[model samples]
Target: MAGHSPADGPGDGPGDNRGDDRGDGPRAACVLCGEPTEYPAEIAGSPLCPRCAWQQAQRSACSG
Candidate 1:
């Protein structure tokens, strides 16, 4: 891409801060299942693990 930089590309490997500004920070616990999440400690609001987040998304998608 013309406007993109190397940092905009895929993460080279582990410990790479490609997705967000938070880099290798502490992971947060999921509020529903008490499982560790990818979310950083400074992230706003509650965090949900991948499983719980998927379930929650399903519920929201199927709800009337």
Candidate 2:
């Protein structure tokens, strides 16, 4: 761990800017809140902010 850290992993690091095997090209904002999304809008099908996603997850969890 002298020259790198765990956060230096593929997706965690900044080396995914070239649309590599991970297929990460350019990211877009959340369609609902206009916040940055982890993946592109197209890939996600619909952009969702973390806050909104968490809320949605909570709702979904409660559905059971």
Candidate 3:
């Protein structure tokens, strides 16, 4: 088992969401709910979580 899962750690406080990664890739918070995302917020450019990012992607008019 990973010794540093979010549930097992202290978690990123609201004021400290720097989208930094401890291990297993970079991490960022959801711009809407303040929840951690699978990818970094820098990519999203909006501090959005995976769920929100995916939702935004789906809502996009692009198909490629």
Candidate 4:
């Protein structure tokens, strides 16, 4: 309960943009599946496309 805050907890609120666009540029590949990706966003040191990012978000929400 100490580490779980309703507002700050994972997937409990709006998505965070702080670490979304940490890449150098656009056009990258998904780190999870290694597929073509644009608007490259760094997630766990891997680039992810919008579609893959959405899927990852959903997964994270469910797991958290």
Top-TM-score structure, candidate number: 1
Which residue window of length 10 is worst by lDDT in model 1? 14-23
What number of backbone clashes does candidate 1 have, counting pairs of residues 3 or more apart or in separate chains?
A: 0
Query: What lDDT is reached at residue 52 by model 4?
Result: 83
lDDT of 2 by residue, 1-64 (tens): 6989665666634555544332555667887888877776457478687888998899999999
- 2 or 4: which has the higher TM-score? 2
Assess each prediction's global lDDT (C-alpha) against the native.
0.81, 0.70, 0.66, 0.65
Global Cα lDDT for candidate 1: 0.81
Compared with the true structure, what per-residue lDDT tens digits does model 4 show for residues 1-64?
Answer: 7787666745522355444443457456777777767655443467777788999899999995
Model 3's TM-score against the true structure: 0.38
Greater-TM-score candidate between 1 and 3:
1
Task: After superposing candidate 3 on the true structure, give the runs of residues whose Cα lies further than 4 Å from its correct spot.
Answer: 1-27, 39-45, 62-64
TM-score per candidate, chains pooled: 0.60, 0.46, 0.38, 0.40
Please list the residue runs of candidate 1 whose C-alpha ends up more than 4 Å from where it truly belongs after superposition: 1-23
